[model samples]
Target: MNAGPSTAAGSAELRGEPPLVVDLDGTLCYSDTLWEALLLFLKHHFWQAWRLPLWLLLGKAGFKAALAGRIALDPGALPYDQTLQRELEHQRAQGRRLVLATGADQRWAERLAAHLGPFEQVLASAGGVNLTSRAKADALVRLYGAHGYDYIGNSRADLAVWQSSRHAYSVTRKPFRLADGRHTEHIGSVRPQPLAALWRAMRPRQWLKNLLVFVPMLAGHALNAGALAQSLLAFAAFSLCASSAYLLNDALDAHDDRRHPDKRRRPLAAGTLPLPLALAASPLLALGAFTLCALFDPLLLAVVGIYLAATLAYSLRLKRMLMIDIVTLALLYTVRILGGCAATLIAPSFWLLAFSFFVFLSLALLKRYSELFNLHSRGQDKSSGRGYTVADKAPISIMGINSAFLSVLIFMLYFNSQTVLTMYRHPYFLLGIVPLLVFWLGRLWTLAFSGQVNEDPVLYVSRDKVSLTVLALCFGLALAAT
Candidate 1:
């Protein structure tokens, strides 16, 4: 977030008239908590309900619009300690001016700014300016003159505004989970105890990813009749099944996660979620999911078995292999799509699967890249496979390359396919790749580079702007072709 004005060297007279410039992220709203909630939201609502290509078009602006309606983003999103509240109040009681400044976009800044009772104005980056430290420093200098008022912050980056301010204060308590790699927010206590914590632990984002099963059937309406019913059943079954896996994974990872800065706040690691309860909950959820599948389609039950096995393998073994772990994740997603096709007796084009894998792999690689950056900053070795360690940067980059190419290759092949030709009703629909390519290559990689990329590909796309535009254009073209 933008630091307040720097202090002048000589005297109080030299220090420009300082309005209170408050940082948005740590000072006002806790980023860690919001992100966790956002992750949950993406999994449950956006991911499953929105088509990937269309979701890609929603971008951050759209997502922020979504958040305004769905979340209580005002001052309530920022649950702060009593001590901080008094400190802010003390500052407010003073004649000092108040302005909310942050590295986050104007939307978030405004959302947060509206709730800060005393702030005079909110200054934030529009497209990209407000997201990094240097920019924040520049903003502080531009907005608040030399030697301004005392500044309050939480992270090392705040050291910039901290050092420059006449006086500074830092908060030690953080309200985010340890496993959460977002370092902008400090690790803090979870408000709710074991029960609420367990509910949160069941990740809804994977449920959105599970919607992959529906894509093929939607793409091919001939399989729509009976397959639609079966697909809906699979979706329900997998949602419960994935929740079970999340509970089990959190329990197993509690030991390791406790060591993590963010994961430590997780229910099990924090001692809020009891181990026995989680142990009981895991298999029971799984069994319930499986039972539902059994009543619907044996083939679906088998697919869920594979999903369970793969996830178990991931929890038990695969997560340690770095590149292999990512590959496994991609395959698992592909299998979900393939499994649906099998259950419905519909054949997915080989080219389609190829394209899907590559596209997802690209996003998976971006997640790894972000992980590597975070791990390296923490002075951890990247060689460990569970989370991308900094050591294997080459493979991650190479995997991204392959994944991008695969997306192009798949689309190109799809262009030649008779199914696409028949459905599209126009040879020109093949040109849809122009926007798709630009959207994918530009938008996703930018997020990865910016360290804003989400672990789930669908999540990342849903929050990107340019990608969404291209996606919309492509869809409009497809409609025209049809």
Candidate 2:
């Protein structure tokens, strides 16, 4: 413990000043412990989630204590409001008593206090009592007498406490009106617009992957306006569903993401985006996706249901498994093509499925390899939330390289099939795409090996000049064949 300012206690004795009490969630800490603990509980003990309502029946305090007892959160890893912390330290240096008063469970309060404080006292929820709002105000009034202490807090729940305190300080973006007609000091400026943060969290760039939904329509030569419109609708639906999955994945991974070099900047992980909003938006987005699917063919909706289920499974458990995670990722990409076929009422060709599977499989492996490579570069042996160690890098690269070549071979066989003759006016023009595919895949792996590829390979390809150029060339070749 940092016993700040050796003469602080003696100094406070000379001056009779009110103790400074600070809120925990959203005031001193950028995150809510309850939400973080709950998400982690669900992530690790999903089966026991049925007990949540039962626990809640024990009242808010019991529910919080139950969760704290089950999972141990690292207080040091939490995102704290640095500005507020600095102000608290300054006050402590001035010999003002600092109190940590929060609605969080006593366990978390004590842990956080020990990790980052010279707090004179810790007040929090305990013994089946939830210390918040009116209860918190009443307790403080009883302990320090009404208007005898200064308080710093955030959120509407703090209003009652502010009314009971002598001075009010806030960390919230919006100004609050104190019922007691006292001034509330704003500590920091408002964060970036919620819409901007939401947009980033939605990750519209990844929607590029949803473009695969148009592949079946293009391959089947269903260029009619009606077919094109349906494919576009399928694209929109899949994009929304994919965003929903991304939100859920980010929420579950927020803790682990903080340990990552790049992912730590994600909205939820960085605390720029509120966890409750992310959790709420996730299901709403899924509902909107399903609503869009309902406007299309029934089969398309069924395909989307499968896609959502698979994505949920992948986010929940499959992603933590070794090889299974990679295969599941490839299957998700193939599902987009299936959605296209269902939307346009086109039968999927065996060759199309075979080529897509191997191609996406290779890309999936590349994604994992990139993550492992980053970890290895940092001298870490194991990935934070993954099953792979640095030692698996070589085998993953070999398998990925082979999968890429196998996909090329599948495309070659596809060019020779009678199906190719029916769709192309000049079938031999399609052969030009083979070398382009090989070069693109080889270049991607080379970058991964050299540590240039630091994110998902599919997302990387969207921004990669060389890969985009290769894609354009392949498209031109296909257009000539058509």
Candidate 3:
């Protein structure tokens, strides 16, 4: 029973008359994905996933609707379900009005209604301002005023009203021939994950950070015997530690991860690898990493502890914080340098500590800027943490400039260092800074503006042919300086 537009394009035809009430969750949103997550949450943390449908049919849409309300936006809803336009139009032409009636928040439900476009009346979950279940019925009856409706809804939550409606029409893409004679129309195909999703999330780009392990080992070049062997061990151990951290982060971010498009497909998020097995394997993997460190100085254990704590805190609550979170990462990077020192017994020079802190923090800020710009440009900035709005220029302009300056100072400081200054006969690392900056800050800002740098700049830079060449030049110059 279609009526007037919800409040947008075709809604004006309602003439304050009886309109259709279509629910949001199953009818408009690809709610099954959300349902699956809730199902999994219930299974892993509460009960089993298979019993969700049974619970839904048991007049439990109110509870289910509340749960679904937690995650308001789906990652793939750039263009939500639009196939109902024709039928809605047909019904509107037949002198019926259209409205949205749901057990979801009126505020959030408004967005779904807007996407459907041009509805006259909207009846939604009034849990906040009004009652949701029976009150929803009261609102609907008041709006239609005995004219009644061909109400479209998914669950038994609609049972009370379905009996009151003139005709019951169920929207389900999955074929169903009702015993009462009406058939569920085939809407279209349900979308599946594309192959590219896996590649994006693995973020092969950020793997560049793993190379930092080699930095300590490379610094070990100052040591004479057994240095290479020790360095290789450190690299292996560090890689394992990083991988372990990644696994742990993904596990903690299960819900938020599912809300992210690229992140949603992570093996753990997609339900490809069950959490129990992953959780069981994590400590074993971490223990193996610790074993690698134990092969070196036992002091390396402290380094591993700090790494674990910092990353765990980041995954837990630190990530939600804004600039402080960025600085926390800056300090965490210092911890890595300290860890390297612990592993190799190399006392970190004051300059190295200061420079690394600034440079790494600069990189972290750029990473934030990149993510911020991407979200803003792509109209996905609701996930922002820096308290910046999509339209606000302060985060980008102020933070971006600050990070670039810090990085440039780091560049200058490295050149000004006696070690680098004395080693480079040609004074080339200074010149190399030009392209390095272009590649470092320039390419990153470019990718960010284009919304292509959601991952890490280092990883993306490594893949860029020009950036790779510049990095090679920097490395060669640094080696030459050595």
> Cα lDDT of all candidates, in order?
0.63, 0.89, 0.58
Give the 10-residue window scoring lowest on summed lDDT in candidate 2: 1-10
Q: Model 3, range 1-482, lDDT digits (tens) per residue? A: 23223433353444444556666655554343334445335423443446556546635444455555544544333223445556676556656677777666565566666766657777765444332445666676766654276566555555555555545555543434444555433332233343343333334445456556556545434544564455456556656666666766665565566666666667656644444545555676678889877766578776877787787777656777757777887787677667667666766766667766766776677677666665666677566324445554456446665766666776676666776555456565456665676556666666666667655666666677876777677777656645
- Model 2 lDDT tens row, 1-482: 12322234544441367888889998888789999999999999999999899999999999999999998888866777776677677777777789999999999999999999779899999998899999999999999999989888888999999999977778766668888667677774355665677789999999999999999888887879999899998999999999999999999999999999899889888888888999999999999989888875778899999999999999999999999999999999999999999999999999999999999999999999999889988889999778999999999999999999999999999999998988899999999999999999999999899999866988888888999999999988988888
TM-scores of the candidates are 0.57, 0.95, 0.57
**For candidate 3, what's the RMSD?**
10.2
The prediction achieving the highest lDDT against the true structure is 2
So what's the TM-score on candidate 1?
0.57
Shift in Å, residue 202, candidate 2? 1.1
Top candidate when judged by TM-score against the true structure: 2
Worst 10 residues of 1 by lDDT: 1-10
Better of 1 and 3 by lDDT: 1
The residue pairs in collision within model 2 are: none
